[model samples]
Target: MRSQDENGRANHEAGMAGGEEMEMVEVSSEMRRRHQRPRKEEAEETEEAMSVEQVFEGKRVPGWREQLTFRAFAVSFVLAVMFSIIVMKLNLTTGIIPSLNVSAGLLGYFFVKMWTSVLDKAGLLKQPFTRQENTVIQTCVVAAYGIAFSGGFGSYLFGMSETIARQTTELNDAQNVKNPKLGWMIGFLFVVSFLGLFALVPLRKIMIIDYKLIYPSGTATAHLINGFHTPQGAKLAKKQVKTLGKFFVFSFLWGFFQWFYTAGDNCGFVSFPTLGLKAYENRFYFDFSPTYVGVGMICPYIVNISVLLGGILSWGVMWPLINNQKGKWYPADLPSGSLHGLQGYRVFISIAMILGDGLYNFLKVLLRTISSFVSVVQKRGATSTLPVLDDGSPITTSPAVSFDEERRTELFLKDQIPKQVALGGYVVIAAISIITLPHIFSQLKWYYILVAYIIAPVLAFCNAYGSGLTDWSLASTYGKLAIFTIGAWAGADHGGVLVGLAACGVMMSIVSTASDLMQDFKTGYMTLASPRSMFVSQVIGTSMGCVIAPCVFWLFYKAFKDIGISGSEYPAPYAIVYRNMAILGVDGVSSLPKNCLTLCYIFFAAAILINLLRDLAPKKIAKFIPLPMAMAIPFYIGSYFAIDMCLGSLILFVWELINKAKADAFGPAVASGLICGDGIWTLPQSVLALAKVKPPICMKFLSRNMNDKVDTFITSLS
Candidate 1:
C-alpha cells in the first residue's frame, strides 16, 4: 500500500509533482512528536496573554485617572518637532530610520519627573507628572515619526526635493513631463495626510476592538511607558524613568559631536581599499552610518543576518561578476553616481526582491483580512452597514443582511466617526485629488487621479490590517504596486504616467498615516487615552511635520551643498529608487540592461518562492525565512548598513547574554537614545549654516558636479 502522502497526492485534483518525496518525509506519530520543533510547541502552547490593563495600567498610579492635559499637548508638540527633524535627516542621508516613541516618552517622562522632584523639594508642587501625561506625549512623537519617512508621506519627497527638481529639469530638456515643484508636493501630501485623520474613527472598531490585533510594536511601546512609569514595580531598578532620560540626552549630544566634527560632504566614513585588486575595491570596506547601529539595535537577529547575506550576494559576489563582463552586462564606464557601477544593476534586482517580498506578504494579509471578515460574518450570520463612495454609490452592501435585535448593537457605527463626516471628507479629498493632480504633474493620464482616490481607502484598510496585526506598515510595498498597477493602465501608448507616480506618493502617505494612527489608537486604548484627543494631537503632529520637515531638508542641503550630484556626501538612496521607479512606470523595464532585467526577474521569482514556501512550512521553519524587507534593503543599499546595524544589535545581544532580566527593562530606553542621539544634532548644524557661520568642522559632498538645484529652487520660490 502507498504511504498517506502518496494516497493524498493521488486523490487530489492535480497530482503532487514529488509525491514520493512528500510521502518519504511524512513521519510516524511517535517520530513526529519526538522531533517537533520548539517553535511549533511554543505556538501551540495556549498561554494566557497579558491583559491591556496589566501591560499599560500604571502599577504605581493605577489607570484612567487623567484626561488630556495642557502639559501633554505642549510636550507632544516639542517631541514631534524633535522626532520630525531627526527622522527627516536620517531618512534623507542614511536611508535607514528607527521609531522614536519610547525614546521620546522616556525623555518626556524624565523632564517632568525631574522637575516635579525639584518642585517637591521646594514645597511648591501640588502634584508630580503622571503616567497618563507621559504616555499621551510619547504617542504624539511616534505618530510624527511615522509620517516623516519614505513610506509615511511626502516628507521623503521634500527630503529629495532637490533631486526631484533636477530630475524634472533633465526630463524637461528631454521633453518629458515637468515634475511639480517641491511646495506643490508638500501641500498635496499635507492635505491628503490630514484627511486620513477621518479614517481614525471608523477604523477603531475594526482594527482595535473587534479584530483585537496584536500590534506588536505598539504593545512594546505600551510596556516601555508602563515599565518606566509603573508607580511601584516589585523590583527597585525597574522604576527609573530619569535614567532613561539621561541615556537619551547623552546619545543625542554624542551624535551631534560625532558627526558635526567630521570632514567631507558626508559625516559617514567609507573605506574602499583596492589592495591591488582594483576591480574589487568598492566591494571591500566599511561604510559607517550611526543610525544603522541604532536600527539594528531594535531589529531581530534574523533581519540583521538576512541584510548581511543580501549585501554579500549583491555587492560582494554579483557585483564582481557584472564588473567582469562590464562591456556586455553594463557600460565599461558605469554611471558615475551609481556606487561604483554596483547600483546600475544591483538596484533593479534589489527592488524586484523588495517588491516581491512586499507584495507576497500583502497578499497573505489580504487573505487574512478576507478570512477574518468571512469568519465574522459566518459566525454572526449578520449583515454589515457599509459606507458609500463620494459618488453616492455604496462601497459595499449586501441585501441578505439584517441581524437579530441583539446583534444590531454590534454595528461598526457605535462610538466611531460620524458616517456623514467620513463620507464628506472622502468627497472633498477626492475632488481635491482629481482637480489638483493634473495641474501638478501634467503628464499623468486623467483617470489616474480617480484611480488613486478610488483605491486609497482600500489600500488604507489593507495596509492598516497588516500594521494592526504585525505592526509592519507595508506602505512602501503597496506604493510600488500602485505605481505599477496605475501606470500599467497607460498601456501601449506610454509605459507609465508621471501623475501615477506622484499619486503613489500621495497614496503612500494616506495609507501609512492611517496605519500609524491605528497603532497610536492601540497605545491610546491601553493607556485609557481619549480617542478624540489623540486625533487632535496626531493632526497637530502631522501639521508640524509639514511645517518643520522642509527646514531640516534645507538644512541638510546647506550642510551637504551637493547632494544631487553623483557621488555626493548624501546619496539619498531612497530618492534615487523613487526617481528610477517613477521613470520605469513611464518607460518599461526595457530601458534597463537585459542582464539586469533578467536578474530582477530571477530575484523576484526567488523571493516569491521563498515567501510561498514559508507559508507552507511549519511555523518554526518559516520563522527563519529572513523577512523580505530586511534582506532586500541591504541589497538595494550596501552591506555597510547591515554591518553597522549588527554592531548596534550586538549591544542588546550582549546585554541579554549577561543579564537577561534587566535587558528588557532598560534596553528600549538605551536603543531609543542611540537612534535619536546622532540625529537631532543635525538641526542645530543646519541653523549655523543658514547664518553663513563657518562651522568648527565642515563636511561637504565630493561629487564632480553636485547640483545645487534645491538651493536654486528655494531661491526661485523665495
Candidate 2:
C-alpha cells in the first residue's frame, strides 16, 4: 500500500513536471471526457470518482466539527513535541531540514490506527479513525514544528546572541545582541506568526480554484492520507510502523554508543577523520551523523551531490588557495573561526552566492506569478456568464470543471472563511505587531514593522503562487530581502543588525505562514477536509509552536555550553552568516577583508551564470549542474556532513539497484527512523549535559609524533 501511495506521489510529481502544458492537456481532457462515452476502464474510474464525490457530499465524510477531534489534537500534541525536537536539532546542526509531511502523516496514522484497533478489540470504540482526522494531526504537527524552522532558532534569532556576535569581524552593538529568553521568545512568536495565516485567508478560492495551482506537497500528502485509511494500507502501515520502530531504536542506541566516545573535543565518530589527517584538515570526512544521512535519503540526489560539490570546491580548492596568500590576503595570526581571516572569505563568498541565487529566483518567481495572474484574469474575463462575489469567487459557475474538481470545489466552498473576518483579523494582528514589536526589539522601530506588514501580502501571494507551481517555498529569501532593506534603512548607529534580524523574523513568519496555509488548503481540498478545520488546526499548532519551539531552543541553548560556536557540536552555521548579512547591510563593503569583495563579486556573478546555464542547458546536462544554494551551505560549516549525505545517497542508489519496489515503499520509513532516533536522542543528551554528566571515553586521534610523545611520557611516569 505504501508502494502504491509512493507511486501516486511520483505520478503527481511527473505530471507537474510537464508544467503549464500538462495543465492545459488535463483541462482539455476533462472537457473531452464530459462529451464522450466512457470505455470500460474509464467507466470504472468514473464510478470510483463518483463514490468519492458521494463521500464528500456527506454520506461518509465527517463534518468540520467531527474532523477536529480531541484524540487528533492529543496525538498532534505528542507528535508535535517529538517533531519539534527533530526540527530544532536539524535547525541548529545543519540548518537544512527535509520536509516531514509524509512522516507526520505516517506516524499519525500509526498511532491513531493502534488506538482504534485496541478500542475495537475491547469493544469500547466510539468512533473510527478517519482520513480527515489524520489530516488534522498531520496539519497541526507540521504547523507546530514549522515554527521551529521559521522561528529562526538557528539563524536570525540565534544570530542575535553575544556568542555569535563575537565570531564576526564587525563591532556589534552591545544593545543589539539579545539572548534567548523563554518568556520574550514566546511573546515574540505570538506577536508575529499568526498574521500570515490571515494575510492569505481571503485568497484561498482564487489561488486554489481559479489559478488551478499544483501545490505538489499538499496533493501528495493528501494521497498518502487517503491511501492509509484503506484496509490494505492499514496492514502495510503496521509493517512500516514496526520497521520505523526497529530502526528508531537502533539509531537511538547508536547515538548513545557514539556519545561515550565524545568525552572530549574532537573525540568521536562525529569527527572520525575517515580520510586520514590531511583530508580531515580540509573537512572531507564523514562524521557519521544519522540525521544528515536520513536527510540525504529524503532529499533529491541532485541536492546531496550539489552539497558535496560545494564542499569540495570550498574546503578542497578555494580555501587552500586563499590560505597560501596568508598575511597578504588576511591576517595570519587570527583565530581559525575569526571573520577577519579566512572565515571572512567563507562567509561573505557564500553570502554572495546565496544572495545572487536568491535574487534571481525571486525575480523569476515574481515575474512568473505576475504573468500567470494576468493569464488567469484574461481567461476569467473571456468567460463571465456567472455572477461573482467581491472576492472574485463565482456564485454558480461550473463550466470547465472536472468531476473530481467540481466535487472538491463543493466541499471546499462549504465552509469558506468570510472575507471581512479575514481582513479584519489581519488588520488587528498587524496593528498589534506594529505596536508590540518595538518593545520586543527596540532597534526595530514601529515604522519598519508597519512597512513589513504593508508589503507582506504582495510578497506572500508571490511566494504562495510560486510554491503552488513548484513545491519550493522562498520564505527565507523574502526574509533576507527584509534584512537588507530594513538594516540599511536603520543604519549602524541605530542597531541596524538587530533591527534587520527582527524585521526578518516578522516578514518570514508572515510569508511562510501564508504559503503554508495555502498548501494546507490544497490538502484540505483533496482530502475533503473542511477549510475551517485546517485553519483552526493551524492556529492551534502555531500557538503550540509559539511556546514549544522557543522552549526547545532554550533547552539546547542552556544545555549545550558551546552552541552557536564554530567547530562545536551545534555550529548553527547560518547564525553567523545571517548576522554578517545584517552587518553588510549596515556597514556596506568596508567590513570585508582585503580582496574579499572582488572574490564575492566573482562568485555572485558565477552563481547567476550557473543558474542560467542550468535552465538553458539540456536535461541530460542540466541534471549534473550543482545548485548554488545547496553548495553555499558548506562554505562556512565544512564538508564532513556532505560526505555523510553522499554516503546516504550511495546507499539509496545501491538499494534501488537491488530492489526498486522495496526501496520506494520503505525508504522514507527507514530514513525517518534514522532522523527521529538521532533527533530524539538530543533530548536525553541535553539533559545529561545540563546535569554535568560526561561520557566515559575520549577516543581522540593524534598525529604520529604527538602519539609517540604521549606514549613516552606515560612510560616514563610508570
Candidate 3:
C-alpha cells in the first residue's frame, strides 16, 4: 500500500498508501442513505449548494457550457509544463512522486486569481475565476503531468532500449532493443492514452454514485478547489504560495551550490559519505537530496520507515552476506553489472518482492471490488426498477437528500457524455490501435493488439473501481502482467522485449487514463463542476501531455549521456528492472544466476507473508509492519535515498511534535517547495550539461591509502 503517488510516479495512486486504515473506513452506508434522502430535502440542499458555489458578486457558478474557457486552458498549459517537469524529474530519479493534485489546484487558483484581480482593478474584467474553472485547471494540469509517469519514460518505455538492456545482460542485446524516438513515443501515447477516457465514460455513475467508491485524492482536490474560491481560503492560499516560493528559492540555491562541486562521478554533497566510508561503500550515506526529503515529508510515516528498514536489511545485511559467497554462488570474475553475478541477486530478488506484493494487492482489491459490486447489486435487487439517468444516478424524487450531495450530483450529471459516444469512441480508438500498433512494434501482432483492446476495458474497470475504493492504482502491476504475458507469447526471437514493453504501455495507458478520468470526475463532483468540462479538460490535458512528456524526456535523454546507467544521476531504476523482467519472461529462469531463483523464491514468499501478517495484525500493530513494496525498492536501487527520505520524515516528526496544527497546515507547502525547487533545477542543469558546461571542481573522496597515493602522484607531477 506504499501508493504510487508516494513513488513519485503517477498520482493515480495519490499519496502513500495510508496502510489498511483506509479499507476499514466505510462510506457505503452513509452514501446509500444520502442517495435515498427525500425529494423536498434534496431540493433545499441543492439550493444551498448552489448558493455557496455562487460566491462571486452577480456571477453564478459557470455551467459546463461556459467553463472551458481559453484562459483556463492557457493557465493549465503553464502549470502543466511546471508540474510535468517536476513529475518527470522525480520519475527518473526516485520514482516516488507525491500526489500534486492539491498543489495543482492551489497554483491554478493563484495564477488565475492574480490575473483576474488585475483585470478587475483596471475595470476590464469580463469574467470571474470560479471554482469550476479552478477544477478544470487542476484536472488539466494533473492529466498533463500524469503523462510523465504513465507515458513510461522512466520505466517500460525506456526499458526497451539497448542502454537499459546492457545493464541486465551480457549478450548482444542491441539487436533486440528498441530505443526511444520522439516521433514514435508521441504517436504511441496519443493512440493509447485517450481510449481509457472513452472506456470509463459509461461507468462514471456506476462507480461514483452507486458503488460510492471514495476516490480520496479526487475528493481532496475538490475540497481544495471549493475552499480556494472562498474569501478566507484565498488569504491562506496566498500565504502558502509565499511560503512555497521561499523554500523553492532556498532549495534551488542549495542545489546550485551543490552542483558546483559535482564535476565528476561521486563528487559533491549528493554523494557525501555521511555515515563514514564503510557505510558509504554500502550505499548508506545521505545524498542531501531535497527532492527525496520533500517526498519523505509528503509520504505517510510508515512508508519512509519501511524504506529505511528495507535498506538496512538489504545493503546493511543481505547484500554483504551474498557478496561474500560470490565465488561459489555466482561467477566471481563477472562484471558488476552482469546478470550472472551480484547484480542478478539485486535485480531478481527485488523483482520477486515487487511481484509478490503486487500480486497480493491485486487479488485483495479484485476480491473487494467483486464483493462490493455483488453486494450493491443485491441491495438494488433484480426486481427493483430504479429509473436511472444516463449518468447512472437514480431518478429519485427523494426529499431527504443532503444539500452537498444533491447539488454535486446535479452538477455532476448535468451533461452526461452520451452512452453512444462513449461506446463508439472506444470502438473506433480500439480499431485504430489494433491497425496501427503492429506497424509501430511489428512484433506485436494485430491479434495481440485486438486481444489487448478486448481485455483492456475489463481491466480498466477493475482498476478504476479498485482505485476509487483504495486510492491505489495498480496500473504498473497490470502493466507488469502485460509484459510477462506478451513477452512470453512472442518469445525472444520475435523481439519479445520490445513487444512486451509496447503492450505494457498500451494496457497501462488504458487502465491508467480511465482511473485518472474517474478521479477527476470525483473532483468535479464535489466542486460542482460540469462533468462535460471535466471530460474536455482531461482530454485536452492528456493531449498536451502526449507531446510534452516525451519532449521533456528527450531533453534528459539527449543531455545526460549516463542517464540510464547504474550509479548515474538518473539511473531510471525501474527501466532496467522492467527490461530484465521482459528478459525473464522471454528467457525464463535459465537466465538467472546460479541460486538466484532460490533467493527470489524466498524473498517472494517473504513479501507475501509480510503482507499477510500486516493484514491479520491489530491496527496498532499493522501500522508498524513494513511494506514489502517499499522494502523492495532499496533492494535494487541501494539505500542512499532511504537516508535522505528518513531525514525528511524526521524533520516533519520534530515539527509535528512542536506544533501539530501548524505542521499540518504548512508541511506540504514546505515539502512541495523543496521538491519543486530541486526538481526544477534539473531543467537548467540538463541544459548546461547539454551545452558541455562543467562544474569547476570535482570533490572526490578517497580511501586513506588512495588519497595518499593521489597526493604523492600530484607531487611527482608538480
Candidate 4:
C-alpha cells in the first residue's frame, strides 16, 4: 500500500512537473503509455491477474460483476448480422475467412467509448464500457462468426446445396429444386450445433479449468479485451487505438484503391521477379496488406520463416520436380483446380500437415485428459473415513486472502455461470440432438443415431482437447472419419448417401461449434467475464445463424451470377473441400485418379515427416520451424494471395531483425489494425458490387486508355 501510494504520488508529481510542457505539446496516448507505469501489478490492478495458486487449484477470481447487459447484447447482435453477411460474401469470393474478434473488439471499444462521450455531455453516462461488457460483445462476435462459417451457413452458401442436389437422385429430379432437404438441414444444424454446446460442458471442466489449457487465439483475445477494460489496460490500449485508427483508415483506403481502382488486379500484392526468371512467371510476389504483415509480426519469427520455407519448398523445389516427372509421378493433365501450379500442390501438403498436426496434438491432450481422470479415480481410492460428510467450501474457496490488496485483487474471480442453468441448457441441447440428428437425415436408422449420440461425447472430447491445447481443432478430419463410419453404416451404398454425407457436415458442425464454445469459455474465464453470458451469447448467435446463414447465402447466390465459375468472385475453398469429402465418403478415395491419390500419400507423409523433424530438431532450429498450417495454407489459395500473406510475414520477419523489442511491443497493434482495416473495408465494396455499381470504373478506364502511349513506349523499349 505504501509503495502504491509512493508510486501514484510520484506519477502525479511528474504530471504536475510536465503540466507546463503539456500545454506546448499535445499529450497523446503514446505519451500517457510512455509515462504511466504500475507500481506493482496487484497494487495498481483493476482486475488483478490470476495468481499462480489460482492456476494450479482452479480457483476463480474473488469478485462479481453483472456481465449480461443491453449494451453488450445490442452491439453483439448488430455486429453479428454485419460480420456474418460480409464474412459469407468474402468467404465465397476470396476463399479467405477473416476472424472478426479483433475487429469486434476494436469497433466495439471505439463506438462504446464514443457513445459514452456523447452521453457524458448530456449528463447521462456514468462510466465507460466495462471489461465484462466488452468481453460479452466479443463473445457475440465469435459466436456469430462460428455460426456463419462453421455452422453450415457458409458451407451452404458456397456449393453444399448444389452438391447435395447433384448427389441426390431424388433431389436432382425435383423441378427447380436445390437441396430438397433444406428444412432438414436447417434443423440438423441447429440441433448439432447447440447440443455440442451443452454436451461439451463436462469436457470444459477437464480441459479448460482443471487441466488449465490455453486456447492460443482465445487467450490472446482475452488479453486484448483485458487491455480495453481496465484503466492501466486502457492506457496501453490508447497507444494502440492511435496506431489502429491511422492504419485502419490507411488500409481501408488502400484496399479500395487496389480492389476497385485497379479492377481487383492489384489487390494487396505486387508481383516481384525472382532472379528475373519467366519460368517463375510472377509466381513470386509481395503482399503489402498491413493485416498480413501484422500477422507475420504477431507470431514468433521462426513460424514466419517456416511459412517462407514452405512456399520455397513447394513452389521453388517441389514444382520443378513435379513438372519434370509429370507423366511418371503426376498425371499428364492435372485438374485445373487440383495442383494447377506450384500453388495447387501446396493445398494437398497443407491439408496433410494440418490433419497430421491436429491429430498429433489431439493425442497429447488426450493423455492429459486421461491422466486427469486417473488422478480423480485414485483420489477416490485414497479417501478417508472421516470425510464422509465433507464440505464443498474448502475446495471452492481460496485460502490465500490474507491482506486487503489480496482480497481486493481476487474480487473478479468470484462469480461464474450457474451450474444448474448451464446443465439445463445442455440437457435441452442433448434432447434436440437425439431427436434432430436422425430426423434430418431420413436414411439413417435408429442405430446410426444411437451411434452418433454415443460418439458425440468422444468426438467433443478430442475436439475440445485439441482446441484447448493447440488451438487447432482437427474436427474436420475427425468429422470426416465419423462421417465415413456413419455414412457406411447408414448405408452409403443406397441412393440416400448424400443425405448421410450432409449429416456428417452437421455432425462436424456440432463438434466444431462445441470446440469453439469451449475455447471462448476459456477466454471468458481469463477475462473474468461470466461463462454463462458467453454461453448465452453463443446460443443467441447460433440460433440467429440458423436463420441468417441461408438468407446471406441466398443473397450472394442471387447477387453473383456465376458463383463457382473460374472467374467468379467467390472461390470457396472450404466448400470445395467439403464437396470432395462428400464424394470421397460416397465413392471412396480409391475411385479418385491414381496420381491425385499418390500425391495425397506423398504429401501426407511429408506433412508428418516435417512436423516430426521440426519437433526433433534442436531448440535453436525448432523455434524457426513453420507450423504445418503455414506451409499448407499457401497451396490451397491463389499464388498472389499466398505471396501477399508471406509478404506480410516477411515484414515482421525483417522488422524483428531491425529491432526485436519495439517490433514485439508495437507490432501487434499495427498488424491488428491493418488486418481489420483490410477485412472491414470489404463490406462496403461488397455492398457496392451487390448493388451492381462499378466504382472507380470511369477513373480506371480513363487512366488505362490515356496511358496507352506510355505503355507502348515501355513495351517497345522492352
Kindly give the stretch of ten consecutive residues in candidate 1 with the minimal lDDT sum.
1-10
* lDDT (10s digit) by residue, model 2, range 1-718: 0000000011111111111111000011111122232357645754565555444454477899999998899999999899889978876777666656777888999888888889999999988888889989888988888788778888889999899998886857586688888888999999999998999899898888766676756766776787787667777887887888888998999999999999988898988878998899888888888888887776567667878999999999999999999999888999987877898999999899888877776676566666656656766755422222212343333466567777788989999799998999999988988889889888789988888888999988887786675554667777888899998899888898999999888888888788888878988898889999999999999898888899999999999989999989898888888899999988889878899999999999988898788877876687678777778878888898888878887888899899977887787788889989999999999999999999999998888998999999999999
Q: Taking the tens digit of each residue's C-alpha lDDT, what string does model 3 give over 1-718?
A: 1122311222212133421111101011112223335668866855765555445434576878678988899999988888888877876775666656657777788899999999999999998888889989888888898788778888888988888877776333554688889999998998988998999899898777756676756765665677777879888899988888999999999989999999988899988898899999898998988988887877666767888898999899998999999889887899898888888889899889888887887887787677666655765643222332213343434345555666667767778899999999999989988888877787889888888888999998998777776566777777888999987898888888888888888888888788888888888888778889999999999999999999999998998899888888888888888888888888888978778899899998998899888878875687688877788888877888878878888998999899987787788788889988988888899899999999999987888999999999999999
Model 2 Cα RMSD, 1 decimal:
6.7
TM-score of model 2 (CA atoms): 0.91
Computed on alpha carbons, the lDDT of every model, listed in order, comes to 0.54, 0.78, 0.77, 0.52
- Clash count of each predicted structure: 9, 0, 16, 18
| Residue 187, model 2: Cα distance from true site in angstroms | 0.7
* Residues 413-457, model 4: lDDT tens digits: 344455675568766666666666555444555566566766777
Off by over 4 Å in 3: 1-59, 170-175, 381-399
Sort by TM-score, top down from the best: 3, 2, 1, 4
Cα error, candidate 2, residue 123 (Å): 2.4
* RMSD values, in order shown: 12.0, 6.7, 5.7, 11.3
The local lDDT score (0 to 100) that residue 499 gets in candidate 2 is: 91
TM-score of 3: 0.91
Descending-lDDT candidate ranking: 2, 3, 1, 4
Alpha-carbon lDDT of model 2:
0.78
